[model samples]
Target: MTRPPAKAPAKTLAPVVLIDLAVLLLAGGGLAWLVLRAQATLPYHWDWSVLPQFLAYTAEDGSWRAGRILTGVAATVRLSLWAGALALVIGTCAGLMRVSQRLFWRLCGGAYVLFVRNTPPLVLIFLFSYFLSGQLISTLGLDAAVAGLPEAQRPLAEALFGPLRQMPGFLTAILTLALIEGAYMAEIVRAGVQSVEQGQWDAAYALGFSRRQTLIRVVLPQAFRRMLPPLTGQFVSTVKDSAIVSVISIPELTFQAQELVSATYRSFEVWTLVLVLYLALNLPCSLAARWLELRLQRSDRGA
Candidate 1:
């Protein structure tokens, strides 16, 4: 005998979805009201047409080249990528030191986190730009070396380092961002490491694994799974913080936006476009992190 038709799963809106929709609607309404109020009070005229030219333009050869805003975005992405990699290295070392059995290592790690975490990022940027970068560059003779490179090799050198004139400023920004982000990343790494069960450590020890072997083969693997979400968050934070480098004239997105505003006197439109650009960068990251977290949780449950 044929079975009766199977029932379809019920379709229902999630509470979180409902809440998000409500929040978005309210935010849109509020923004509309604010814009209307500003239009009545301010003498400013909004011309969005000029904004596209700042993002891209056709060169004399008819090939499209990145304009001011796109150039700024590229710079920001490059800075964030370099800074994030450096921060990961610093964070991992500091995290391992924080969890080390050696007294000196622990003290060193603690001191780094304490000092960096306590300091404001802006102050660090200025201090590094003025003092650390200049001394380090001059002592290393980086400027002279770059200046002496052959024409063919200069492009490679600039790609490896940065623009010749802005090398010090760029390096200072990267170092400052890495160190600041490293402190927060250190704590996240530390927590992830410690979250591993004590039973796992005991089991590894019983199985004749050395301290190093157990951490490398056992603890870190599990800790990394847990660390993915927070690590993704820290990377996003690095992207946002890279904007601070613009204060020292690193020519990142915010800096380019500022230049555009000065030239066009279209502060509101320019800033709104920049705000959306940041959201474009960050929203994907946030969604991906959530998806990864959920997938990991499901795998754990299935296992």
Candidate 2:
């Protein structure tokens, strides 16, 4: 007979920790008191009045549209979507190469993962922007192409990637984010693939499936299911990590936040609102990841 899972420790799932509830409350209250005292002493003028203006404004065309804050949010979502998709593609390919039988492929994958994961993202962005993207954009005349894009397509293009003028910088950010995220996602994919039973592999081989066919048809399906939780976590991570590209002035949330602070001198207010916006964007992703993890756990128990 199989052994049953041990009962979880009551403390682990307990809603309230009565053991130190008073101490916890006292500490929390003390922190809040300290913050209120500091704010009182600070010379900063907190103007929340300008916040609504930044959230929505009337354009020169007399059409009401999103202001800097919402525009930044849109830019962030667009950057994350494009970068995350490319990262998934790069990660899947590199991850499969990691588990390949061929020595050369394994070496290539290892080198890629080693190089990217070891390098700091700040360094990666600067290096890629100056060395790679600059060359490609200038050589391909992407700016001219963007500028020459028909007016009919301009609205869609702007919606997807901000203004045409910003396209070169935006593309660079997308490339860098995808490359950085891909290295980590590769390991997730590898671990998920390896989680499958060796017996399953042997059974597939017994049925005359080629290596590629087995991986594609059988292993991938199960592995992808297992990968869903971590994949969603990585997707969240990508959205958060997109903030790092602000150094390159890609006009994502952080960059726009900086711009607003400069214009309004409401550092605390701007950053607090940014915190809220980031929470709004990432909280759903986190909840979805949690649900996926729980679902996977339930499936495992059933199996």
Candidate 3:
């Protein structure tokens, strides 16, 4: 038998989309006009001469890729990666604890969530920097070992220390971002785990699976799929939050931007460049997360 003919796709246009585009264009034009007018009225013009110099090298500050900019970017990326990893570990444990039968585990998880949620992130950073971190560093003695490395290993030493030498400056920044992010991630994880049908747990138990086996084989895999989108979002947030470390002089992007602005006295240019740099780092990740989310959703629907 011959197959039936396929129907043609209907042609349609949404008026709302056109209206939105027109409004956006009008607003953009207005903003551009305002900026031009403001620039013309300025008492001093920006020296375009420094633009080429900035684009080339910042030799005066002894940095070829502009003073501290690459260092700041590296530091930000390092801190973000480290903090995200730490947050995942912490959040998973806390999430598991929140759902546990043990009172102590539940209480510990609850306390962490409440404390982190109630505290402002900046204050948390400060607390870690000045108070908790000293105790932690003393307890760990990690700094002493770092400082005790031999002269032969000084290159290795400096390479490691270049990003995080401060007693608690780097540690505090990492911990602060991790702690704050972990609270949100804990909730995401808890919800993902709980979203798995109770029937799965019962079936695993009926099959004589141990608690660990059941969690590892059945619950966690499903939970992880559900958790990926939120986790991706949290990762992006962590990158942005690394900027807050500048307040404590951890030498991340925002701090370096401030240094540039102070030295060049070009606040607008410095800030705009910093904004673009952050967007460059973050926008692609956000896009990837959205794409992954859509892909997972489609798979879920098909399943």
Candidate 4:
């Protein structure tokens, strides 16, 4: 047993390392070429320095504070957070309805999915903004209540819901995002729930579990493990789709970027920064999903 001529670690890794380095170099070269080509024809001067001011600035007292871009990012994150939460709730319910034994519940879920999935998201945003949200706010007297809040409490309301003037718009955006994303989320949930072995249901029933108990205790847990990856993906999609609300002037990231571009005349730089900001926002969700998936896989193997 001569150790098979001592397998060299460097020899084994060299090809992979070389390939990775080659890819990086090619990407860098392509980016450089594109930049050079753009700079040649585009007369606008790049001013990356101004971007930081929009993202953060030092006040007169020298205290650092978030600037317009940072504010916009916050708004975007806030919108996505609320929208994602609501979407989950709506989607889970709709998905349950989709898989319900009752014909009426299934039909209701099916109709909702069909209508929302078939309609354009932008159109939904507008209709909800104008008709549904407006009526709800008026019926609920939300605007009046917000307006009448004590001066001290007004800031709290603004912080929670956005500028009082735009509260309706913000709520509208959230509803639209939830309804639209919920349609897709329902399908994901339905599929995940359905993917479980039918024997699992039989086993739960054999254990004298009621349907609801079986679903809540036995089915959903496993389905949830299966659903985590796609749920994370839908949340990421929610973040990106939140940008569309900018068209209705919600002052989210894209809206703020547009404002910055108009004022700074730095379309390329502003958009590039905005693009990076979005990637920064979404990349963590993607990574976390993968980590969770791996953890689940390990747990399954261990069991």
TM-score of each: 0.88, 0.86, 0.83, 0.91
Pairs of colliding residues, candidate 3: none
In candidate 1, the residue pairs with backbone N, CA or C atoms under 3 Å apart (3 or more residues apart, or in different chains) clash, namely none
How many clashes in each candidate? 0, 0, 0, 0
Per-residue alpha-carbon lDDT of candidate 4 for residues 71-181, written as tens digits (9 for 90 to 100): 899899889999999999999999999999999999999999999999998998888888756698889887787778899988887888788888877888888889899
Candidate 2 C-alpha lDDT tens digits along 136-169: 8888888889999999999999988888889999
- Cα-based RMSD of the predictions, in order? 4.0, 4.4, 3.8, 3.2
Best-performing candidate as measured by TM-score: 4
Look at candidate 2 and give me any clashing residue pairs: none
lDDT of 2: 0.91
Model 4 misplaced regions, further than 4 Å: 1-13, 59-65, 150-155
Q: How close to the true structure is residue 257 of candidate 3, measured as C-alpha lDDT?
A: 77
Candidate 2 TM-score to native: 0.86
Residue 92, model 3, lDDT: 94
Candidate 3 similarity to native, TM-score? 0.83
Q: What value does the lDDT take at residue 275 in candidate 4?
A: 93
| Range of the 10 consecutive residues with the lowest summed lDDT in candidate 3 | 47-56
Model 1 segments beyond 4 Å from truth? 1-24, 150-162
Q: By TM-score, how accurate is candidate 4? A: 0.91
Worst-scoring 10-residue span by lDDT in model 1: 156-165
Candidates 2 and 3, the one with greater lDDT: 2
